[model samples]
Target: MQAWQAGAHPRSAPGLADLPFALGVASGTPSHQGVVLWTRLAVVDPLDPRVHTVRWELAEDEGFQRIVQRGQTETQQALGHAVHVELQGLPADRWFHYRFMVGDAVSPVGRTRTLPAPDSPAGRLRLAFASCQRWEHGYYAAWRHAAAQSLDLVVFLGDYIYEYASPRSGLAPQAATPIHRVHELRRAVSLADYRDRYALHKSDPDLQAAHAACPWLLTWDDHEVENDYAGLQGREGASAEFMAQRAAAYQAFYENMPLPASVLVQGLQGLNQADALRLYQRHAFGRLARFHVLDDRQYRAVQACRNPSESSAGTVRPSRCAELRDPSRSLLGAAQEQWLAQGLAQDSRPGGPRWTVLAQQTLFSPRHYGGASAAAQADEPTPTDPWDGYPGARQRLLHSLQATPPRNTVLIGGDIHQNYVCRVHADPDRPDSPVLASEFCGTSISSHSGATLERAQALQKNNPHVLLANPEQRGYALVELNPQRWQTTLMAVDQPGRADSALRPLARFVVEDGRAGPQRES
Candidate 1:
């Protein structure tokens, strides 16, 4: 049994050491002078809905001697005994250490940094983007490696946790087996179940280290609640029951993440659950880059008439479903689309950001058939679970970029387990179409991609826009943004399933100033 799950003691029965701060420490959503901090109090039985006061502090140094900002807050049972401190009035573009204290219990110190002045000419940013981490899939060696890099920021795209259930008692990773881990409950159906699941995943040392290493910008894909749920509607249409389930899931998500209170799930605002939580937001690094974090799932008109939850429904040709051409349907919804357009337009005008990055979940660029993998070669429809499934929305996004293309725009996405480098085109069919931006689809931290290298090579041959594809590796993209160029290193881990795996630099691609496509750096 894990240390925190040792017994069935009541809330006040156990000492501070045995009862609180079980999820470690995390910080996120950094502005030039503000950031959010997070942690959940642990207990022998998490069901204890008692109020616990937590003290938090910020320091310029790792040691607590140099105190900067300190305060206290109480975690209420209504919010799952969790705390999110949105600290403001800090300096710009510098590192800070922070921690939480619950009575005698203390959390590990975490490092976080605010963005530089909006007009400052920032030098470089070494940021890593990752997504689709299924706890039951493999060890979090990738997170350990990322933590060691001392990244300024980590962009978590989605799938932070999976919904598969586990045993009610004696939960643990199975020995001598593939898919090494076993869950404790049935697929998470209630708020308590989701809380238990988060506690379980947070217990991993590597995950904790990653959280302590840097601030994170996170969003949920499907697994955070249910598989392929979009907006008020789920994989199955929205129902009163599903709304309740979604509300519970959203509350659980808010409680677990290091997000600001602005996105906190207060209660059901409407039947659609439109007011549950809003995660889509923007972040800019002075004149270096601007990141438009998107929410494709929340407001999307379910995946083009097909069930997005099913792997077999998406990845199709226009002939399979012609309504995909309907421009009225949107992935970002009309309001967010306009919001993104205006932001990009503002950035595209007169000596703006050196780079524009759409930090989101799911791949943006297209991947055609004729690859070596049997599936790729089968001439079957491509997966529509991502942008590929929402052609109209993708086209509109591409059209907007083409109209006012941002300088060295780069789209960073995750979901597909393989790594890919492609150039986005106004017309996906026209290989020579005006390149609106560049795309780097980072491979998964450890999720499985059932494709082979030979198939990937075949895909590259057929898809002219695709420059590189690695179907059988698991790792993240180490991105370095400079004033004149944006470089992304494909860091592939030797073994994802192994806890002691190592990350090796597989390839590097660079997009120079005023450039629209990637040039591989050897």
Candidate 2:
């Protein structure tokens, strides 16, 4: 199916015969017949409000040696100096390289690939999912390594850019966490801000290489907007004005992303433009695997970071029980939950596919460090921000799986900024029972690490479901799958600042048919 169905229109702007500083080019959300390509024309000074035409050429070879699809489109300064072209009629399951031109300026070349045939046979699939990259904390060394490897797809699970300004302190646990002036905050709330943010991120050679390497499936987490926002609410609290600000945040986000115009037309209104725009959709990787992308932050209830203290106690500390357990709370919301349940049921049918992978954010497994003696565990006032906080929502999802029981179901997640391999179960105590599923959570490409190694040792002992957990590492996880076996390599980049950062295999884990969990160090 074509991702974009073009309609007749009078040219809103002049054709590529005029512009300068053709900023960026990206091909995203590929499909059988078409792929969406993006380019933004930048005028040297006093960004003009003129119409400019742009042309994109997609080829089977890197040199544009074999052109398969070509198109010309116009961009207007009113539309944030951007051009989005959806090129159709390309063959399915093939790699294509595309470039854009506006006037005399040329955009960087990018590579994108389409989904496999709708009914192809189960064979092989390779994917890399990573998240929580803070540019100021470290370099994108792991992304550089990942881009060099051949892969079917990349799933970026949010924190694409942090909303807050740089932290004054280097680490997370500093006593006086340096905070940027609230007024000085560069929260991205406008089209230019979003464009500039993307430009800054794209300036990283590693991120550029990775985008050039494969098509990405993206989902937004709290950092993209405000921390732990529910619908239009903002942190510190929610209000109508806050919601308006949120709307601006969402619009800025859509403007910079590789999404189609349909999603972009929300116009600073933080509501669904179309019911069919499922942030969580299913994609088949040949016949080998199916991926279910999810958005958990959009539909959740506004959670108070900590419960208010009781008057009887007369203390300002958090209450023992926050409202996180509210039964009505949701992660994927009602519509998305239904879509995912239906997709899981249909994809896991007998002899349908080899694997069912849920590419999402946050860890699904429950972990508790309440009883730990380690400083890291004892120091933290609350549990990690994960699905573990929403027992009801997590249970609902687990029950959904229990009902469908897809064979070879695996969960892939990246948001905790740590590497983890765990066995997801309907009941963690009964690990030997009919295995529900398994999960591989990737560490950050170059973000803050979790607890120190000394503390991680104690935390791991308490969390048995977590087969492996590395908090101090910076890198990505590579999952290799075939019809019979699945293997994962957790590679850690030495450091980010150095130009020649090397990725080393920190751990290797494998899972075979009928196994509920992974076998470590194999």
Candidate 3:
């Protein structure tokens, strides 16, 4: 029972023109004891400055007949009237119903569950991993299907809201479907602008349903703040102006998310700076699995060999640029790398998690986009955004895995708007190197891809480790894990523009208990 109050409550209930719970309810970051409940008050005016009292309740049943706990909290204009209730000390491994109330209005009921006890014997885990949901590209039929899967959790690997606006030109070449929606602003630059963009995205019924369905473990990619932003630097370069914009965007992201208040407190402690928000964390589901949620965009080194005139990331030949081989440049900063190494070491111990899950953004394996010959590949240009750009960092990560290998390591990610099922090797360039893990990179939810089936096939011919690559479909990945095997079903939508699109399995792959690579099942 915690609350923030500026003054005493009003004597009479204040009336509003519409329901305040227009954006809907959500829950996230579940643990053995409890989970986080979230909702934002959507009023008639965006500039409402008054403090409003919001009451919340947790129940053993949906009818509120068996109330377990209840509390009241205050929301104001500063925090965008968003409410986050971090519940703890509750019963573990059970379903609970929750909702919010203000005056006579009540929010919709949401269902959430806690993870099994750490020492308890858990059998299985079911989850869906998705990413890159641009509002303008297509409808959220993929989210609707995900909501119906009865999943235990949803791991969202960033690009939840794109930074683009309406009438986006030069997108027809990559987009397979027509634009179904448009952004409210040309580009989000201020706190208000970012907030409005989040509000617009949260207004979708399918996205809301997906949030309400179960708890989500999330991490962001480039588009949340800006496309191809690295550390304190933007595409244009590091500046005070870009830092201010980053501060605003980070604040907006915190207010709209179902994150705990401690994250915000940590951000403010940096001399009232909002440029950074701690997002990388770890979650455990009993002894069955451990999820290492990583943030790659916030602390990465700038793209190597970038053109000075155009500071944004682009393709470059690694053989021509010596910086591409520099050992100091890292995709994950030194601190984060050390943290991950320690976590990996701990997971290899006895009574540790059976499955080690690395949930992050973008593809992990090396992608060669040039000719088949070694000399031609060395001369061909490759994108500097993914792991291929920072070969030394990739080598270090693979070295850590080889040093302290976890049982049944699995890596899941999304970006580039294409689905790839690959075998992560100790050294991707060497064919004889040992397979360290199995990777499943999902396609975008609504974002477009310029890749074709023929192009994907040709690329796979050059990279034999990639068992499957498909860019023609759009959907999410359904992963089912147990003691014996891990199964992934690639769910694809028939028509992305239609609201009631039918979903089909694009492909299926399975990894056995002791195997390090995924075997194509269909």
Q: Could you tally the backbone clashes for each prediction?
A: 16, 3, 0
Superposed model 2: Cα runs more than 4 Å off: 1-23, 45-47, 168-185, 234-238, 262-278, 304-319, 371-384, 429-433
Q: Model 3, range 60-86, lDDT digits (tens) per residue?
A: 999999998899999878778889999
Estimate every model's Cα lDDT from 0 to 1: 0.80, 0.67, 0.84
TM-score of 1: 0.91
Candidate order by lDDT, decreasing, is 3, 1, 2
lDDT of 2 by residue, 327-356 (tens): 676767777788888888886687666788
Show model 3 residue runs off by greater than 4 Å. 1-17, 168-177, 234-238, 269-275, 308-311, 371-373
Model 3 weakest 10-residue run by lDDT: 1-10
lDDT of 2 at 364: 84
lDDT of 1 by residue, 1-522 (tens): 222333333555343335466578999999999999888877654556667778999999988888889999987877777888998999999889998987666788899989998988998988999987776667788888999986989999988887765333324345332364555456787888788778777888899999989999888788887877766765445477777777778788888999987774454343235745778888888889889998887788766657544533445556666666677887778888999999889889886898999988888887777443445534447565688777788888888898888777899988888899998888887787788789999988877787889988988888888999887778888988889889899988887767789889989999988878898998
Candidate that would win on TM-score: 3
Compute each candidate's TM-score over C-alphas.
0.91, 0.85, 0.94
Comparing 2 with 3 on lDDT, the higher-scoring candidate is: 3
Return the lDDT, model 2, position 68.
86
- Model 1 lDDT on a 0 to 1 scale: 0.80
